[model samples]
Target: MSADRVVQLRWEPRHVADDGRVELSYPGISVVSSRQGEVVDRKWVPVGEEPTFADDEALIAVLHAAWRWTRPAA
Candidate 1:
């Protein structure tokens, strides 16, 4: 059996800028999106570990998951 890894995402509202793009920040990760909600850039704190940018599909999946996770229960 394989265990699933849970990613804890923490968004910092203070870091948000006037730009159309939205910035989501976690412990050591940051995801930036375009005004239309397309991911434009991604970065890791301290740098130099993995690729800075993520695949479009992967980024979308993560954003969707995060939205669902934060949505209020009906």
Candidate 2:
């Protein structure tokens, strides 16, 4: 039998502001949540399908996600 694999997912958030933007993000995703826990902006990548990648490719995707979340609303 093949070994069932599972990847952990996590979300990080920054403090809330009157501007209604909470810096929410995951390992390979970007998201913006409101003070009311409403998701206004978000990003998700389909990594589950692959479950494997070259070292650089995996790192780059993670970096891009983080950049998107912290990016200055461009």
Candidate 3:
């Protein structure tokens, strides 16, 4: 069996508007996976909007899906 992973995410504003709508920088989503309190894996993705995940697994799944969808046709 594998240890459970926990995800941590951070968002930084790319641009701040007068109306208070901030544009998150491309690849704004930073996903960090930790196991036993030690980070194991990390990835970045341009979600294009604020993303919320219930847990690390959810975040990872969404990132992978987004990446696949955005990849150029081969």
Top candidate when judged by lDDT against the true structure: 3
Identify the leading candidate in terms of TM-score. Answer: 3
Q: Write the number of the candidate with greater lDDT, choosing between 1 and 3.
A: 3
Alpha carbon deviation, residue 58, candidate 3 (Å): 12
For model 2, how does the per-residue alpha-carbon lDDT over 1-74 read when each residue is reduced to its tens digit? 11121122345333435556655332343333222344444444433335666644765665555444444453
Better of 2 and 3 by TM-score: 3
What lDDT does each candidate get?
Answer: 0.42, 0.42, 0.56
TM-score of structure candidate 2: 0.26
Return the candidate ranking by TM-score, descending: 3, 1, 2
Model 3 per-residue lDDT at 11? 68
Candidate 1's C-alpha runs over 4 A off are: 1-54
Write model 3 residue lDDT over 1-74, tens digit each, in one string. 23354656766434445566764345456766666688767666545444556444565686675444334355
Q: Give candidate 1's error at residue 42 in angstroms.
A: 13
Model 1, global lDDT: 0.42
- Residue-wise lDDT of candidate 1 within 1-74, one digit each (tens)? 11122234444333444465867433333444332344434433322236355544565666665445344355
